[model samples]
Target: MSSTDHAAAVHQVHRDDYGSRLGMWLFLFTELILFGGLFIVYAVYRFMHQQEFHLAAQELNTTIGLINTIALLTSSMTAAMSITAMQKGNLRFSKWLIWVTIGFAFVFMVNKYFEWSAKIHHGIFPGSKDLLAKPDGEILYFGLYYVMTGLHTFHVIVGVIFFLFILRQIKQGKITSDRYVRLENSALYWHLVDLIWIFLFPLFYLIH
Candidate 1:
């Protein structure tokens, strides 16, 4: 059938349809711009206060950041593979793979929890210089660090919620080879969260 027919078919049950995808893409573009601005600000600070930034970066746990990086990258691979599996009309495999992806997401958050807990215990909070034990100049580094990583974590939370909803849709037969837009878009969101972390790890953890 024609594209119009396919969309008309989806309109009945799929609230999003093509229009939803289009809207999501547009919204993602706005998010991209917002992150782009934050990145620019980070770059400026890093360049001007290179020494302090590097020292502040060293304050972070490279091991934890690296571990999370590996986890998220691995999850992205799993999610991509699941999409491929769905395209091949393999529901069981796709479902299992999605569950695996969610598992990795859980692991990533768990690691983040431990990492943040340690930081909090050490009293390294935003706008708390005595808490962080750093000089005034070094304050900006940690400030931006918290903001960027915190925002990225929020995105991860959103992605996890989205995938859980997709899991429900799959169980109820709302998603299948016949209609995988939900899967496809959820995968896209997951990938974006992963991509953000990739940039973040190097910027915040690898400065030294």
Candidate 2:
């Protein structure tokens, strides 16, 4: 093949990679707007019912929140480092780091499950007799708490699935040093998950 033709082909490949990254960023933008709407609702309700919100938030377990925060932050580090490892041509090490990040995600989920179970056992879920008797502000607070956290939990599950896909691609030799955008995009999504939780942990757990 002619040198000019080869150059054009290489340029097209990079262009496609850039296009994929752009698409991912656009999707992430939509996700941000989605959560932003929820944050606005939270703020308005908190403004209207400061005392009740405060009281209800006190019921959340701060210790679990803190632990999950650390776990996610650490996982974010691992996810980022995985890309670095892949760039360094340490493919095996990259895969291991991705698995570690997935492990942390599971830990976060387990902690979340226990926390929710405790609340449910105490009859604190929405529409339960105990929660129903609470003031409207507290009820709304718990309601949003369930919704936002539940949505975030779903994102975590999706992220785990995405990481699994990345693992499969890596094993199949589809993601590598020269073509690693998929891995980078996966890490970006995971970081977004961690970032959302950073905000969530403080708003629901520490604010009280």
Candidate 3:
């Protein structure tokens, strides 16, 4: 290729990368808006039923929530590390860090499973007889609990899938030191996931 043509191609690539990052940021902004609305709703209800919210929060296992928080926080770090590894041209290490992030995600999910199972076993789920018998504030608290945390759980699953795809791309030599915007975007998404849970852990488990 001629020098001028090569320069034009390089400029096009840079524009594409910039566009991709911008798109990802816009998408993340939407996610934030969604969660932000829920948070507002939560705040209003909690303000109206402070004691009940406090009591309902006590029903949650703080230890398990703490463990999950740690897992997600660690996973976020690993995700960032994976991007750095890629930028440093350490493909193998990058892949390994991604795996570690996935492993932490698994840990978080497993703890969530047990925690949810316990709640269900206690008949505390929405529409259950036990939940229906609770005070309105407690009921509302649990309702928000399940909705917000459930939504966050879905994001965690999505983040895991994104990482899985990223791992495959890395192995296929599609994602590399020169081209890793996809990985970077996925890491950003993961960080958002972790951040949402940071809010959730305190709201649902530590309020008491």
Candidate 4:
């Protein structure tokens, strides 16, 4: 290829990389705004119903919450390490780390499933007869709890799917040491998932 043509191609690759990163950042920003608004609503309601919110929080199993928190934090670490491994040209190890991260996500979902099952079994779910009989603050607390955590859980599922797709790309040699922006972006997304859970853990489980 001509030198001028080669230089233009390289510039295009760089531009694409920059554009991908910028796009991911913009998406994350929108996510932040969504959860930020929910947080503000939570804060306002908690302020208005401090006692009931505190009491409702007591119904949550802190132990299970702690376990899920640890799982996500560890998954975040694994996701980041996967990117580093790919950048370092350790494809096999990077793939292994991605699998590990997905495993952690599974653990989180399992725990959440059981937790929700327990709540539902106890008739504490939104709009249930038992929940409807509770004080308004307690009702609101569980409502927010279900909505926020459910949304975060959905994000976890999406992150798992993202990693699986990245794994496929790695296997096909599309994402390699020199071209791992997809992996990097997925890790950024996983970190956001973990960070949201960080806020949620304290808000829903530690309100004593």
Candidate 5:
């Protein structure tokens, strides 16, 4: 109850917040590396089979891709709004925003499933699909498509889990308007997901 004891407690709280922030940044860095490798692969393919890739790109479901893009961008907006609510110490509002974002994310995933299945059913899938009846190595284009989008899907799944954890933290009173670093970090992750899709849309569905 003494002034010195109160000061010590405040300092400990600041230190704990700093540690959480640092951990989040470190994790973000690791995520950067994981996405980096995929970018490299995309570059190599773009350079190696520019024509085939372009042709393949034209075959992609651009409408579906654009729809998914909008969904993700909307989710990102909701996430940003959630963070703002958290900063305002409005936990209830923040939770609702988070739930809204999760809903959009799920919709994105479901749309992607349809897009993929359509391609797969048409025999335009990866690994020399017999469905499309394409020539050898021609189907390689679809191979890259699957790998890139598949990896991106995995990232979304991870983001969903992370978001759920953040919500739990908020519920437990571990997070507050005064100390919600986890929300910001989760936003960063969501933005990364959006960024990847931004590039992906053009590469897989808009090239000519």
Candidate 6:
């Protein structure tokens, strides 16, 4: 082998513990920036139509939003605890906790589906005749509401899939106490999903 090629191969043989985490963080940063842009747009529109925005937000059911907020928060706690359980070599408990987290995720989605269904039933969806007839500010409010919440719902589904993958790894003994970055990263992603909803509930359901 060429000496330069051999040297490169040797360098690649070393495992960098922080490298996986660093990559995950970088990916998360990009996600945050993407959401940040949406936040800016929402802010600008809200400022332009404060009263209408307030009125529009009132149509959302704060009760359901509150329930979802609690569910996501509890799910985050369970996910974090699962990682701890794994680190302590309690694979069975860790698996059980993750399953609970998945259950919470399902609850969140079901709540969201009902909420969206009710709004659509009431002709509150974007471009609906009711919405189109409203003032520009209210229209924008519902529009942003659908877009942001829809995206967040998509994330919740993705997070569920992510946890399922983690559970599979645990079952196969691929994720162990010493090598649990996959689970840790999934937990981080789930937390991000929860955090986004923290803002969303206030903006869309409670501000009125």
lDDT of 1 by residue, 1-208 (tens): 9999988888876365687678778878887887889999988887888888877777789999999999999999999998889889998899889888889888888998888888777778785656457765478887887788888888888888988898889889988887888888888888988888889998888876
Clashing pairs in 1: none
Tell me the tens digit of each residue's lDDT in model 2 across 68-98: 9999999999999999999999999999999
Estimate the TM-score of every prediction.
Answer: 0.87, 0.94, 0.94, 0.94, 0.86, 0.93
lDDT of 4 at 175: 95
Global Cα lDDT for candidate 6: 0.92
Indicate whether candidate 3 or candidate 6 has the larger TM-score.
3
Number of the candidate with higher TM-score, 5 or 6: 6
TM-score of 3: 0.94
Tens-digit lDDT track for model 4 on 1-208?
A: 9999999888874437788988999999999999999999999999999999999999999999999999999999999999889888999999999999999999999999999999999999989999999999999999999999999999999999999999999989999998998998999999999999999999999999
Which has the higher lDDT value, candidate number 3 or candidate number 6?
Answer: 3
Local error of candidate 1 at 177, Å?
Answer: 0.6
Per residue, candidate 3 scores C-alpha lDDT tens digits across 72-111 of 9999999999999999999999999999999999999999
Highest-TM-score candidate: 4
Global lDDT for candidate 3? Answer: 0.94
Candidates 1 and 6: which is better by TM-score?
Answer: 6
Error of 2 at 50 (Å): 0.3
- On a 0 to 1 TM-score scale, where does candidate 6 land against the true structure? 0.93
Worst 10 residues of 3 by lDDT: 9-18
lDDT score for residue 59 of model 2: 93
Q: Write the per-residue lDDT of candidate 6 for residues 1-208, one digit (tens) a residue.
A: 9999999998885666588878888998998998889999999999999999998888989899999999999999999999999999999999999999999999999999999999999999977998899999999988999999999999999999999999999889889998899999999999999989999889888885
Q: What stretches of model 3 exceed 4 Å from their correct place?
A: 1-15
Model 4 ranges off by over 4 Å: 1-15
| Candidate 5 per-residue C-alpha lDDT over 1-208 given as tens digits, one digit per residue, 9 for 90 to 100 | 9999999888874446677767877887886788778778778867877777777676787788889999999999999999899988889999999999899889999998998887777766655337357633346667778888899999898889989999999999988998888788888888889888888888788887
User: In lDDT terms, which candidate is top?
Assistant: 4
Candidate 5 C-alpha error for residue 74, in Å:
1.3
Deviation (Å) of 105 in candidate 2: 0.1
lDDT, each prediction: 0.85, 0.94, 0.94, 0.95, 0.83, 0.92
